[model samples]
Target: MNWFKPPVKSLLKLDLQHFGGSTLFELKQNMATLGQQLQKYEGELSQKAIDPSATLEDIKALQKSKEDIKARFDVIKEQHDVLEAEQKASFEDKSNIQNIADPKAKIVTAKAELIRATIRNQAVPKDVMAVLGDRNSTGGEKLLPTTMSEELLMEPLVKNPLRDISTYTNLRNLEIPKISFTLDDDDFIADTETAKELKVTGDVVKFTRNKFKVFAPVSETVLRGSNVNLVQSVDRALESGLAAKEKKVAFTKTPKTGEEHMSFYQTGETAIKTVNGADIYEAIVNALADLHEDYRENAKIVMNYADYTKVVKFLNNGNSTYFAAPPESVWGKTVKFVDAATDPIVGDFAYSHFNYDLDVLYERDKNVRTGIEDFVLTAYVDHQIKLKSAFRIAKVIPAV
Candidate 1:
């Protein structure tokens, strides 16, 4: 018996209107899924054609299924195109702006134009040139809006604890001169210039272009209601996504190429993989004491909540009031709570420096080949180990 098919319009019309806010995000997903269905069905028809035992009816059934899915896919694709046009219209809608000449609004408008141009492969709005600044200055790169860039820097503090404690800089292709190691003090007169060969070794920390890209798939429906707010929403979403990624990059040691970030600027030598002690508390105290005298004063123990809880549970086991836990500092050093840490980081985090430029490069002019295209949020970032001896991993090894 042949399976009967219903009209595609009646079945799929309500789906677009009611699909989880019907944002371009969902529409694209819906279309991609249907596209795969059509492809798989076509493959089935090919297999059946070569099968001697397969009836013509078998091929017809598969072909009908493929056509049904394609028809539905076309509807959503059309909706996606209509929504993109509407978003472009919003970018062109000057009447919505109370003052077209307002500086902030103009910047917002220019950025919207750029985003729309990226989506549709259209010419960037002529007026955007004024706000875009000199593309030649940073080697064909444009800066992100100042406020938005600052927000990216600040968001890490709110979401990433390690980001808060480490030092920060903004200079591209930057070479920061820092003291890598110290020389012993000479027994000479305080005011006299002695010939003690200025032996403090130094090194340069060079900044490399670090690209942090976030793939934002605008919801088809969300863009439908867009005005100037479209840019704001997209930029904010990028900001949030970048900050979250930064958080991961900060804690992960030696992350892969794209995910490269500051992992406390410590080397294997500085990271304390083992501790000499009889108990958990004693081991931590010994580790802190083992840190170089130069760093001991400013050093703090950075432990994520999980590690901190383990320490508290072990130390407070004796819960004897006479020798209670300090409750704030660990052995006179401050305890900083950081997330995404497997083991506590012990160090003068100030010695771990991260440098990134404010000039952002967006890779536009590329077609949106898939349902979503990645927006590259790029900056030249580098990390410096002012003094390797300043950091140590707080890996606990209680007496067994």
Candidate 2:
């Protein structure tokens, strides 16, 4: 009693002009939506063809609809691919400009451009001008140029070893609570009313505060000389001094004077597992097994640079080295090389924590007269380290 009308669907119409303004990501998303709609229409056509009641006219109409949808989808897909290629090329050009490596070269180029813009009395890009700005812009006194500061910060230096393996906390001073459980008796429990009481023990680990300092003296001639790079010199002195001292304290044991500081090796020696006959890989496996299964996920290996190079030279039966090269990983775990680390240290670094009060501070003493007209540079920082548990240290052995 009811007349069946063929379902009517609106065809998708995309504006070719809109592609110029749209980003590559947006164009891709639009193309995906169009493809899905085309699929849905094709599915409907297939369903109608299989229906016994569908007439020859209905089948022909569905086929025409699918062909039209396919044509439109193809055109849009081609446009999206072209736009994506263009976007990638543009991104690479911008990346090249930002990734300029030489600090002096970048500074010279930026300064030259600023001079040109000033002489012509023309407007320069805010980002380019920002590189020359002295103030932080948020507030407070103005400091060095932002670009110079960034260049100084980017100087390569040794990083803290404990930071790679330990649970990091921002707090400088805090009490870390540790708990342990041990089985004293081997008796199995029966279905009776009597139950053996479990023993639980806890201890508090405290990390006291400590301070480290770096000092350097710069001559007045160097500061005044047009050819001398004061920023680079200052940056090198501060970074090198801090890196050397920090590496020494992190690995080597020092007697506790008025201030107590223990190295990672000294704190977790109980977990040490010796490597027999230069089998470093086997020793690392044993060290990992020493850790609780849950803690093993956070485990990492720390070794001296010389020992790391030696391990990399190890060959398998086929003569291929165990490690492909320096700076490569081992067994999917990160292997960090510390030039100052005397022994190989394998542990779940999350158990060791280092806290700092403030980052390195640079102070210039121009008023202090040291007989000569020299600018005294002093750097100061406060930091402390603590080990939460002994199990964190998986192994510590002298490099073979």
Candidate 3:
């Protein structure tokens, strides 16, 4: 139960004053050597310039050699700079450790002294105190009087009041998970009720995954009826199962497997209006950004949007547009959207996500017809840590 007994010596037992001393000295020495090499090269180049007998080729060769040396020297210089920076950091850390004052040691010592004082006072005889003369002049009676002076009793003996360093040490070393931040571009968007009612033509949104398929709005079924009731066909797009297309593809439908829906233009909700290989990238970026900002500060998320067009075209045959919904083959991953209390910004635009790759773009512009958009997002955490501290100070002696 006794967790602590003050060490006879100071808290800093480790000899860290020389912690990075040798390494730093060596790094500085190496840097000085590199500098000297550069100076020597410069001197050699200058001396060669004074040789009138030197042919143009000889001069050119010397210049080339000097340039090569300078390039190599520059690399060494960069290395030196990096090493020096590390050395400086290490030095600062050692300095911090050396100057550390432990608060825990002081607190423990205070408690122990108080306990010892109480025990010593309790052992004194109460009868002896009652028999004492001069009640005014007699100092406050000890619970059990000892031969020691009243002055010594009045002032409790305290050893190294500032000795407690454990609390301070722990505070200085406190660490938490490290976090980084980035943006993903792909984002999902929903359509307005009015747009759905109008039967507006648009791109068929598509997405893929490693296994299994999720046809969003899979509930949104598409049925064939008279052209007069294209509204019915559009309504079917909201449901899952078969859909008949003959009345011209509204949202350029790739008719691929997995989740397929109409791509509508929504600002932050979705990055692309059309679902295709082109839009797949944007959707992915948006999805990543959402997940990144929401859960992990800086998480490494890997993703590749399923080539719905390739698979869809393969399944649907010659026609790019069809009424059929995607099968499980062409699938996409699902990432829950977590909105920030306040949205994040990147570049000039305030976006919830950021895309690492620029090549991923909208599919509509690339395709001869209105393009298909892709919606997909996948993510996982790589690593992280954090360092932090706090402090509190109290004066045990109250001011009179």
lDDT of 1 at 255: 72
In candidate 3, what are the lDDT values of residues 271-314, reduced to their tens digit?
Answer: 22211122333433443343323232332222112333433555
Clashing pairs in 1: 23-219, 23-220, 23-221, 24-219, 24-220, 25-219, 272-393
Tens digits of per-residue lDDT, candidate 1, 256-363, equal 764343555334433323445554466667767777666677887777776666667766667753233444644677776767766666778887777766575555
Q: Please state the error at residue 330 of candidate 2 in Å.
A: 3.4
Taking all chains together, the TM-score of candidate 3 against the true structure is 0.20
- Model 3 CA deviation exceeding 4 Å by range: 1-22, 91-400
Cα lDDT, all candidates? 0.59, 0.48, 0.27
Error of 2 at 102 (Å): 20
Q: Which stretches of candidate 2 lie over 4 Å from their true place?
A: 1-205, 225-228, 255-260, 267-278, 316-318, 323-329, 358-400
Worst 10 residues of 3 by lDDT: 383-392
Comparing 1 and 2 by TM-score, which wins?
A: 1
Best by lDDT: 1
RMSD of each: 20.1, 18.5, 33.5
